[model samples]
Target chain A: MTLLHTIYLIAITAEAMSGAIMGMRRGMDLFGICMLGTVTALGGGTARDILLGHYPVGWIANPEYLSFTIGAAIVTAMIARHMHHLRQIFLLVDGLGLVAFTVIGCGVGLEMEAHPSIVVLAGVITGIFGGLLRDILCNQVPLVMQRELYATVALFTGVFYVGMLWLEVNSSLATLLALGSGFLFRVLAMTFGWKLPDFQGKEIRGLD
Target chain B: MTLLHTIYLIAITAEAMSGAIMGMRRGMDLFGICMLGTVTALGGGTARDILLGHYPVGWIANPEYLSFTIGAAIVTAMIARHMHHLRQIFLLVDGLGLVAFTVIGCGVGLEMEAHPSIVVLAGVITGIFGGLLRDILCNQVPLVMQRELYATVALFTGVFYVGMLWLEVNSSLATLLALGSGFLFRVLAMTFGWKLPDFQGKEIRGLD
Candidate 1:
């Protein structure tokens, strides 16, 4: 429990920093950068809670999380010059954060007694939607929608956790298993360039 | 009430057509086109309901509305070739839809008896977010944030509605006043190229 909490905080911080990089890339103002970072850090959970009608929204209930993201964004902006050199480490943390989010989301769904399918969907939503929302707000192609096994990794984590719980596995053991497998899968996908086939359904052409 | 319902359907249809055009511009597949249309048509209401913790989300409780968006998208695709000539008509319809959505959203906020500020935010969310979500999905800069008086119109409608209610105005009368004012303002803005000044706050630059 302690480990997961720690990882979740680290994950949000890593995601916020990534958001800051995106903000700098776009030459956004400080407020814009912080806004993007906060959204990136909290978007997925917000989506999940809203979908489940979970009230008070996480950050709204816990201002500290919001503050953490804002502080992280500012710090990232300050250290923007050195970001290039930190990419590798940053990516690793991001991978861990992705796994942490998946596990946490899965837990939330399970707590709600949602159907297995809904639980899996919830996990994937929490794990990936933050980055997707961030990308959308930044006016960039959402990375998850187009490339990599990102959401797939979260799906795997969710499925495994659900299976473990169904088998009456120890709760902590199930969490660790789900987290480890998802984190490793994403890391491997990143290292080996794994990708889901792109959706290339042709769009209709305009008359003009 | 019947008028509002009729206008709501038309609003979704118009918004759906706009979504289809955006999808065509992006070269999306049938499924992608439908997804964009549905989100663009209903995104605002979903955001408003979710933010307020309104249960069941509107579309989930009303599958007919979802079907309407899907049907509209398919129809739009079929008539894509004629869209160039229909732009003006579509723009007018879109303006009307914008007003309809704002009025409906403001009504929702009033029903909830939310704080005046939150009610205004709710109305704006319901009117503007659908288009914003569509723009984000299409990987374009959201038009509302930078240019035009798009969100401003929604804001005006919300404020106007609130003022009317504060003065003990009849609910239906308040709706008409807000809808008329917002629709006219938007049409004028579109015709006259009226715009809010751009935000050009400085962005931090990287060393390298």
Candidate 2:
């Protein structure tokens, strides 16, 4: 398997585990946990494919991905209490997955011959929308919309990768550089508690 | 426009108004209100088309729908407080829209030659997912998943419509019959405060 493909598999597994944890916290049943985990791991790609008119969406074409996500979710659900100690490791893996997802999404957008702007957007969508969907299902405001530089990392990775290709950089090298830089960016942002600005007075009424 | 098409226009407008009101209540800004309204109006079809791998989604294919939704949202945002008096009318139109959306979705599924079950599912998805998505964006458990017989109405409409087609009923007649019956079912359900059964104890912990 290609390096990116390997990372993709690992990332999905991590994403699924995290999603399962969230579902468990919500006291969801087994079916709900599995469904939420699958959506969290694959919803971004599904959304991207649908928007770009890319048919036979990734998981549909490769059903094995479902196995990975569902299996990871079940495993997580069974051992979640013991897994609390792995929080640091989970965060690291999740961050890596975020960046990797961004690069892979950029690859798909490029293959579709989308405009550079759209290509970058596809990447961001693929990177963050899974979590967005998960949060939606959990009945909570999406953290990406209100929290740290999560989406910003995806946006940066996408733009950086697209820019490198535009500059005639080798594709493999560009992917590696983008993933590396983006992961580092995410790590630093988390370590430093970086956050986007929020509306100062959240009660700015009237426009509603 | 055909009868179904005309109803769709009115339905989307009504749906958008309802969505805008929800966003306004959430203290969302003008842009958020418009977006929420649009998503609430169009999200179901967008979701159905994506799942079925149908290209050029409804809104993408006919950008005019966006104008209808956005225009309705903007108007709603401006006069929302006064809209409380129109609750009964709004619910009536929303119910009609729900049934129309189901029939319309079944038509697309039939066009694609999906299995009857999948066709019915598509109809249900197209009928309810808009509201599901709206509730998600507003950060709440989807009422369709928790409350009255809303999704059941879509399910009933789809099955009724598909069964008529199977019996070789004329298409227009089937559409009218399905719409009429589904709308009636919804109205009666509402008038009588019918609801789906919820789990006896919402605190069924441990599956987590």
Candidate 3:
């Protein structure tokens, strides 16, 4: 397979795994698990297409991706007994998905002749929007709001990739460099349990 | 104010109220409450614009809208006790937002010269996406997932609006008719607790 196709496959696998992990944490039923997996797999691309004004949506156009996600969900559920230790795997997989998506998003935005600021925004959206959608579906505060440098890391990586492009770096090399940076940053953060400072909530007493 | 501007104001107010409700339900503090209100207020238009490749994003460009939403959020929070019996009011306000946004979305999509199907999709995105965003931020399964017929109703209204335009109907009349139809459907569903059938989840029992 071509490099891009290979990357897509890896991304899809990571997404499905992330979905399974999210599902297990939520104690969702098999159907809910599949729903999460599909969202994780296709949500970012769908959002990207919508933003680019690409009609019908990528997932709707390619039903196979949905089927693959569903199949992975089933496999995850069946192995739930032995998958108790999959949380670490889920975090890694989510990181991989984030890196791959950010690269592809920036590339697509550039292809569409979008402004630099908008392209960076698109990369961030493509990297994190699916996770946001998955979290929403599973009824959890998204990782973005959970005091992590999740989105900030993605944002930096996106700008890094865009800067490389502007500096005349080869596209392939730029993508590889950007993905590696994002992945390393995330892995280090996960290992060290790093987090953003919490925003002190309001002092008002009767708000709730 | 012109009728369109008046309706837009009403939509913004409705969305802010919805956001406050979501925040309160989640026990969020003032910042979270205000953020939720803004999400509810501008989310649909933002989603539609992003999807349609409309740049600068409507609310982001018109900072006044964001300020208005924040102002509404504060007002709603201050009067939380008086709005305790807010279910009926919430439903009606939500309905109005849906209708006004639907008209605005369709009008913009048409102007952008998108395909009919794409136009309708954009309209629905404008109508219902804010609530979806609010539900996601509040860590819920979004009101639509309950099979509340929310998106379907928006789709019907969008299609009807587009069809009327195709038939050379007056823009004002078309907007009014579409809004009325969507609002009526939403109100009926809310009043009668109408719902669609849930999807049958796949069984995943055996093969790990």
Candidate 4:
């Protein structure tokens, strides 16, 4: 496998395990755990392909990818306590994975000769949709909507990647730019406890 | 417009309004109201089309459908209190809408010449995915997953539609069966507090 493929697997494994972890926190049954985990790992790519009308979504093309996420979920189930101890490492890895997802997402959009608007949209969707799926399953407001610098990082990464490609930059260099900037933005935000502006929830309880 | 088209518009409008109502309950901003409402109105069809690789998703095919849902959301924002008193009516309408979504979903799947399994999957997806979107946005375990008879009804509706087609029944009669049974199932379940068995959530807050 290429370096990119290796990173992609790393990202998917980290994401799926995190999703399984969320399922555990929510006291979800085994079925819920596996479902959410798989969704979390593959949801972004699925959304992107569907949005672009790209047939045979990524995991569908390589069903083995599905097995990887399932394995990650099972491993998480078995090593929850140990993983918790390594949470800091996972955070760094997740940040890296987000960057990887953005670069790959931009490539997919560009490959399709999508509109400039769609390129950026695809990148952001790919970067954040998985965590959105996880948060939805866990019954929380999507972290990307409120988390500092996350979606912004994805947007900026998309812009950078697309712009570089537009300027005839080679694929490797553009990916590196996208990857480095997104990773830095994410890690910096997480380190500094940064947050986005959020709507104040009123908990109205008014009937519809 | 065909009967299916008419019912679909009704379904989307009601689902969007309900989503807007949920946004109100959550004290979401106007943006949130519009976002969740649109998701609730279109999410099921989007999921169904995506899974089936149907191109130019429903809202994309006719942007007016999206506008209708947005309009319903805005209207709900203005008249949320008035609508609260009509909760019973809304509930009944929602039930009917579920039936409408199911038949349309099944038809789409059939048009694709999908596998027997895919036909039913499409039906359930079209029927309940929007509600799932709404509940997720509202930060609740999907009511469809836990509530009795909801997904089950959608499953049966799809099964009935696909089975009739498989048996070479006339299309109109098959649709009628799918719609009637799904509608009755939903209404009866709502009225009688029918529910699917669900895993108990312990609120663990474990090592996510």
Candidate 5:
């Protein structure tokens, strides 16, 4: 398999495990955990494909991906208590996954000949929407919308990758540069507790 | 426009108004309210089309629908304080919308030649997922998963509509029967306070 493909598989497995943990915390049954995990792993790509009119969405075309996500969820459900110590590792893997997913999404958008802006947006959507859907299923405000620089990382990665392509960089070179820079950016953001500005939502009123 | 088309216009407007009200109660700003309203009106069909790999989703194909929903939300924001008196009318129109959405969804499924079960599922998805998405964006567990017979009405409408088509009933007659019966079912369920049995979720544990 290609390097990107290998990373994609690993990223989806990590994403599924995190989703399973969230579902478990919410006291979901095994079925709910599996469903949530699958959605978390694949929902972004599904949403991107639908919005872009890409056919036979990723998981549907490759049902093997379902096996990976469902298996990861079930395994996580079985050994969740022991997972607390792995939190650091999980975060690192998750960040890597976010970067990988963004680059991969940009590739799809480029293949579709979308505008550069739309290509970047597709990348961001693919990177963050899975978590967004997972938070929705868990019945909470999406952290990406309210928390640290998570979505910003995706946006940066997409724009950088697209810019490299526009500059005639080799596709493989662009992918590696985007992934390496994006992952580093995410790591630094998390380590330093970086965050986007929070709007003073309280000042905005009257609709109610 | 056809009767079904007319009801659809009214339905989206009503759905958008309700979504705007919810956003207002959540203290969202004007932009947030408009977005929530549009998603509440159009999200179900968008979701259904994506799942079915149907291209050119309804709203994307007819941008005019956005004007209807956005317009309804803006108007509702300006006059929501006086809406309490119209609760009864709102509920009735909402019920009618639910049934109409279900039937129209089934029509699309039929056009795609999906299996009967999938067709019915598409109908249900198109009927309720808008509200499910609205609730998600507002950060709440979806009421359809917990409340009185709402999704069940969609399920019943879909099944009845599909069954009539199978029996070679005229399409227009089948549409009328399904819409009338589904609306009556919803109204009666509401009037009598009918509800599905809630599973005791507290006893479910261990995965966490």
Candidate 6:
């Protein structure tokens, strides 16, 4: 397989595992677990492809990814009895997944002739959207809003990668640096419980 | 304003109300409330635009909608104390909101020269995506997944609308019929506790 195809496979694997862990942690039934897993696996890449004007959708194109996600979900459900402190694993895998997705998203955006800001934004979206879907399914505020410097890290890495491309840097070196930056930032934040400044405005009311 | 634009504005208003209710019920802060309202109002249109390959994103294209969403959210938060039985109100407004969005989405898809099947899918997406976003923000399974008939109703109505257009029927009449059909089906389902069959294939271990 080509490098891009290999990356896609790894990306799908990460997505499937992330989804499975989320389902097991949530104590959801098999159906709900599979649903959550599928959503997590496809959410970010789906958004990316749609925004990039790709037809048939990525998951729809590669139905095997969907099947893999479902299989992961079922296995996780069976092992739910023994999964302890799995949140840490989910977070780690999730961060790596984000890094992988961001790199690919930025690379694809650049290849598609997108503007720099938009390319970076695309990377951020690819990095964060799956977790957003996971959080929503698990009935929590999206980590994108409440957590550590997740989006900032993704955005920064995207800028770095795009800048390297602009400067005619080695593609492999730029990709490795960008991915490492995001992954390291996320791991450190997880270890230290780093948080963004919370908005101090009066609490809003009347939302359902 | 063009009829299409007017319909879209009304749909946004309904969406804002839905978000405000979600936030007030969830006890989110002001920024959170505004975020919910914006997502509710713009999420469907944004998704449609993205899927149809439109650029700049509709909400990003016209920032006024964002301001309006925030303003509406603030006002709703203020008046929530006096609101009673907001659940029923949500059901009604959300149902209507779905119908309005379906029409607007199909119209845009038609304008884009999309195939009829794609147009129907667009309508269904617009009808449900905002609510899906709202539910996700609130940490709930999306209404569409939990209620299978939800998006299906919109899809059928969209197909009917597009079929009418294909037969050279009046555009306004076709739109109205489509909207009404979707709205009535949803309202009836909500009132009747309608749902699709549940997954009952016995939880097989590692059965992905």
TM-score of chain A of 4: 0.92
lDDT of 6 at B5: 71
Candidate 3: stretches off by over 4 Å:
A1-4, A24-27, A60-63, A202-208, B1-38, B47-132, B140-208
Q: Is candidate 2 or candidate 6 better by DockQ?
A: 6
CAPRI quality band, candidate 2:
incorrect
Kindly report which residue pairs in candidate 2 clash with one another: none
Better of 1 and 2 by lDDT: 2
* TM-score versus the correct structure, for each prediction: 0.61, 0.61, 0.60, 0.61, 0.61, 0.59
TM-score of 4: 0.61
Better of 4 and 5 by lDDT: 5
Report each candidate's C-alpha RMSD, comma-separated, in the order given: 7.2, 6.9, 8.2, 7.4, 7.0, 8.0
What C-alpha lDDT, on a 0 to 100 scale, does residue B153 get in candidate 6?
Answer: 70
Off by over 4 Å in 4: A26-36, A136-142, A145-147, A203-207, B1-38, B51-53, B58-132, B141-208
Q: What is candidate 3's lDDT per residue for B62-123, written digit by digit as tens?
A: 65786788788878767765665666666677787787788788877987999999899888
- How high is the lDDT of residue A51 in model 1? 81
The CA lDDT at A64 in model 4 is: 99
lDDT of 4 by residue, A1-208 (tens): 2666788899999999999999988888888888889999899998888877877799989999989999999888888877888899888888888888888887787787766756776787798889887887676877664446777777778888899889999888878877888788888888898664333335333443
RMSD of 6: 8.0
Candidate 5 TM-score, true structure as reference: 0.61
First chain TM-score in every candidate? 0.94, 0.98, 0.88, 0.92, 0.98, 0.84
Per-residue lDDT of B65-121 in model 2, one digit per residue for the tens? 878998998888667767777888888999999999999999889989999999999
Per-model DockQ: 0.16, 0.11, 0.12, 0.21, 0.12, 0.15
On residues B1-208, what C-alpha lDDT tens digit does candidate 1 reach at each position? 8887898999899888788777766665554566578889999999899888787678756657877998998887777766778777778788878878887887788788889998888989999899999888877778789888889888888899889989999988888888889899999998899998865556756578
What DockQ score does model 1 reach against the true complex?
Answer: 0.16
Task: Judging by TM-score, tell me the better candidate of 2 and 6.
Answer: 2
- The residue-level lDDT of candidate 1 at B176 comes to 82
Q: Supply candidate 4's per-residue lDDT for B78.
A: 77
